[model samples]
Target: MRTQFGSPIDYFLELGADTIHMNELLGKPLHMKYVGQQCLNCGKDRKIYRMGHCYNCFYELPQTADWVIRPELSKAHLDIEDRDLAYEKDVQLQPHIVYLALSSDVKVGVTRKTQVPTRWIDQGANSALEIVEAPNRYLAGIAEVALKQFVADKTNWRQMLKNEVAQEDLFEFRAKLSQHIPEEVRPYFLSEKSDKWDLDFPVQKYPAKIKSLNLTKTPEFSEKLAGIKGQYLIFEDDTVFNVRGNEGTVVEIFIS
Candidate 1:
């Protein structure tokens, strides 16, 4: 799903050369057939090991290095290479942001500065504000490590999907968390007097209870599309499918 920041977020689903405006598909009858898993990186039929990559790809690819998951472990900025030095420099030697987001709960996370609102939307955050903007992923990651002791790093996807989030002020959280920012990264702290970014998801109704649909168990099922938040395709029956989680999986869809 592709998202653009707006009063109400705009969502688009791209399939091959086709682009489907997903907001228009809400409340419609939806049918899905799980085809099979294909490694998105190698473009071959293979079981997805993690993050849409096959087993070998997950371990061998420069993009899937350990530093990707744990930014503090990044070595590219130190002139050392992990998998591919050139690839690491391209991805790691750039601007990064450390942020506070209200997703299920107030959480601290890191992402590229260019991915500002997009990262927040993907996490299903109701509101978000940058605490610091570091020069590279390593700095951002270290900042995250420091802030983690005071705030959460993970989102409760279940509660977030149920729309059970409580109203909270990100700016307030940012103020409170600012004291914990590591000294090395404090110079990049955002004090530009900007308001928190808020997002509105397109949903007719939120589910009373959520049943996460695993395409492996029930590869074929049809349900009324209730709403979409994060990357999950919500069904009227409370069954939700996570499109991002099943990235390498091939599927056929029919809607009426």
Candidate 2:
């Protein structure tokens, strides 16, 4: 006997279950022979048409806006290693954050650590206009701000996550994404931007400085060392050093 989607074989494998018997159907071990499709995000060979999504691609997709509200439940399907894998597939480890902002009927987000769905689930995101998972934190932040600025009043953001919006509404939101992203970073998303030029990225530089200095034994230095109990470090690197007390006074310094 066949159900609406046919036999239960595929669902069993997708869930990684050894034996799956639909309670509504006659009990028997099942297997699914599914047709494949090209993955939209990674272009991987997949049986997405019948599977709904390839497991690899599904795990790689950015978490929805609703993740922040129910992180544990939302991430329940994730195994420990899978979380790390997601990050490896879609993002890199760096100082970055992603936000799923709702503007009327749409939501938009970006993150440096977008692989961690729990981050958004903890942020109370209701839904998103677009989830921009990128390598750099700055780009993600700017993308979110762009969407917020352009689609502020046109869409109902809440309905988008709840599945209340129709397909036409999503298409409209998709079209409007161009008005948000800057031309240079537009390649990160599905749509293109009008202002196509290389953005002048701010350069960060390190300073050469001393973190600590150790001196031969002295009275004041000995007293201060006795009372201190924590991490201390001296860096001759590019970091600025803030010295307190008398500069001429000899003191001991410890660096980690």
Candidate 3:
């Protein structure tokens, strides 16, 4: 899904040639039918092992390199190849941000400087602010590892999707955490604090309890879309569907 930052984030889903304006589907009955599957990499009829890639594509593609997940393992700076050196250098060598975000709780994270608010929005963070601007993913990632020892590095997805959050000032949190930044990365820390981003999701009512929908498990399901937050489609009957999670699964959805 793609998002446009707004008063409430506007979400879009691209399928084939169609662009689904997900926010418009709110409060409408949606019928979804699982049709088939296709690997995002080679477009083959194979089960996706990870990140919408088939087992082969997952292992073979430069995009799915281990450094993608554990950026600290990146060797692109040293001109060493993990999968594809050119691809690695292109992405891993780009400017990256080490940030503090509040979703279910305050957490430290790393992302390309370009991902910015998109990364935070995808995690359903209520607020976020950059703490460091590093030259590459490795620097930002190493900073993340150091900061995680003091603050969380993972989001509690259940709590995030349920809209259970407490407001907090990221600016103050960033200051307290600055002293703990690894000495090597300290030079990149931002002394001039930028205002934290506060995002509003278009949720009509939040579910007290949530039951996840697995198209593979159930195959066919129909429910009224209550709202959308992050990548999950909130439904009236408390069934939530994760669009990004079901990346390679082909399905047909209709609304009325």
Candidate 4:
């Protein structure tokens, strides 16, 4: 699943040798048939261990390094290597931001500076604001860890999908949270004008109840496309399928 931030985020489902324009298919019938799983890393027909990777690739690839989830473990600044020194430095040594976003609720998170809006979109954030900017991922992670004690670090996906978010004053929230920053990373806190980005989704209707689709359980399904939000494709019957969650699943799709 590829996403572009627009008035309502634009989504594209990338199939082999083809791309399906999802927004255009809303309100129409779509048929999808799951064929098999293809390891995104090794490109072999194998069971997906995590994020489309086979077990071997999941354990071997530098992309799946432990530091990915625990940014505090980042050692690129110290010239230390986890899996690959070059790759670690290229990613962890770059600028990163600590942010507050409103999804189901306001939550704290961190991401590379360049991934600003993209990260928020993937998390289905209705709005977001940057609170701090760090020279590297380690400092950003430190900020996030400190803020976690005061605010939640995780988004409630169920509430997010229900579009049941409450309004929050991010500007005020940032000011209060800034005081809690660790002394080591306090200098990196951003004081610029915080801009709140309000995002919309291309959905004719939001489901009152969400029924998730599992490709592994049911190999084929067809339904009328109702909408698209985040990485999910909404069906008329309130059933939603997460394209990114089933990344390595090989499927044939027909939209009409």
Candidate 5:
């Protein structure tokens, strides 16, 4: 699923040669048949290990390095190798941001400067604000580690999908939280008034109870498209399928 920011986020799902405009499908009946599975990384017929990677690719690819989840372990600055030093340096040595995002709750996180709104959107955050910027991922990770003592570092996915969010004054929150940042990383905190972003998703209704779909278990299903939020497709029957979770699954989509 590819997303673009808009009045409501615009979603596109590319099926072979076709790019389906998902926003236009709301309230319409759609059928999907899970044909088979393939590895997203190697493009081979294999069971996806994690997020579309084959088992071999999962352990071999630098993108799946341990540092990806634990940014604090990023050693690119020290020229240490996790998978590939060159690849790690190219990614981990780049500029990164420490931010607070409002999804189910306010959470502290770090991401590459370029990922920006994309990262926030992926987490289904309704709003976000950058609190600090660092020259590299390592520094941003350190700042995130420090801030985690005061603020949660993880998003409650279930709560986020339920749209359970509380309003917060990010400016004031950042001010209070900034005081907790370790002295070593405090210098990287942004003093300027940071821009706050509010995001809206294209959805006719939000599910009160989420019913997750597994393509591997149910090969074929049809339902009315109710909404799209984050990477999940909400159906009128209250079934929510995560397109990202089924990244390597091959499916045929039909709409009428």
Candidate 6:
């Protein structure tokens, strides 16, 4: 049959068409039906496509998986911060994560808004994702820890710190973070002379064995996140990406 373009040639020869259409040249192009399927998580009947996941399931998956592995494009969110950190300026800012992928391996890191990409690139991470949209610095740090657990690579945690700390604040938290790591990984993290601020919680080393944490297995207690049903994703480190929408946090939500 003649195509919509009216080329008068076989439609099957096109890039994505089937040869069967050529066999019956006079027949109309086949019309497929759309069947709704139940959500994998909540068993709610819904439409599913591509890999048994509905549209809602798709976006919930990490958009940064590739972006984190390459950080240059991701640094637009922090151009202003870069200037501040380089000038040794004192700025009280919320923390964010520099999600990294080193030749396909995952790394999770924390930084003040300005120093994140600079810090990641210095740590041998050629690619990175900056989670600049988090609620606060502490929660951003928590997201970093979660991402590290998800990626499940301490080597990614090889170099990370809560920057913008004063000498007294550094003195207070250094003893805590130092207890967990060797002296080698501590130097790059020392706060600048004019910097002031600190982590409320000491950087806790995530257990190596628990790298397989899956959000699918964790029960959902929050009502807001319930709409995010039947949608699950496994990050580079195998941690299941859970849907936890904090106040003012923008989650690219999915519903199936």
- Score each candidate by Cα lDDT: 0.87, 0.33, 0.89, 0.88, 0.88, 0.31
> Could you tell me the TM-score of candidate 4?
0.97
Question: On residues 79-189, what C-alpha lDDT tens digit does candidate 3 reach at each position?
Answer: 999889999999999999999988898988999989988998898888889899999989988998888989999999889988888677788888888888889999999
How close to the true structure is residue 143 of candidate 4, measured as C-alpha lDDT? 88
Please write out the lDDT profile of model 5 over residues 125-157, one tens digit for every residue. Answer: 999999888888888988888889988988887
For model 3, the stretches where C-alpha displacement exceeds 4 angstroms are: none
Runs of candidate 4 exceeding 4 Å displacement: none
Over 4 Å off in model 2, which ranges? 1-104, 113-116, 123-131, 152-168, 192-256
RMSD, one per candidate, in order: 1.1, 25.3, 1.0, 1.1, 1.3, 21.5
Off by over 4 Å in 6: 1-92, 156-256
Worst 10 residues of 2 by lDDT: 222-231
- Residues 1-256 of candidate 2 have per-residue lDDT tens digits of 0112222111111122333222222222222222234544455665443223456655554542233222212232233333344643333234343333332244454444533433222222223333344445445555665666654423332232222433334445657566666665566664432221111111122223322333312222211111010011112232212122121222232211
Query: What lDDT tens digits, residue by residue, belong to model 4 across residues 140-240?
Result: 99889899999999988777877889788888888889789999898888767557788888888788899999988988899999988778888899898
lDDT per residue for candidate 1 within 45-103, as digits (tens), equals 99999999999999999998999989998989999999999999998999998888887
Candidates ranked by lDDT: 3, 5, 4, 1, 2, 6
lDDT of 6 at 146: 39
TM-score of the candidate numbered 5? 0.96
If the candidates were sorted by their TM-score against the true structure, best first, what order would they fall in? Answer: 3, 4, 1, 5, 2, 6
Q: How many steric overlaps are in each model, in order?
A: 0, 27, 0, 0, 0, 8
Clashes of 5: 0
**Would you list the clashing residue pairs of candidate 1?**
none
Worst 10 residues of 3 by lDDT: 163-172
The positional error of residue 83 in candidate 1, measured at the CA in angstroms, is 0.6
Specify the poorest-scoring 10-residue window by lDDT in model 6: 221-230
lDDT: the better of candidates 1 and 6 = 1
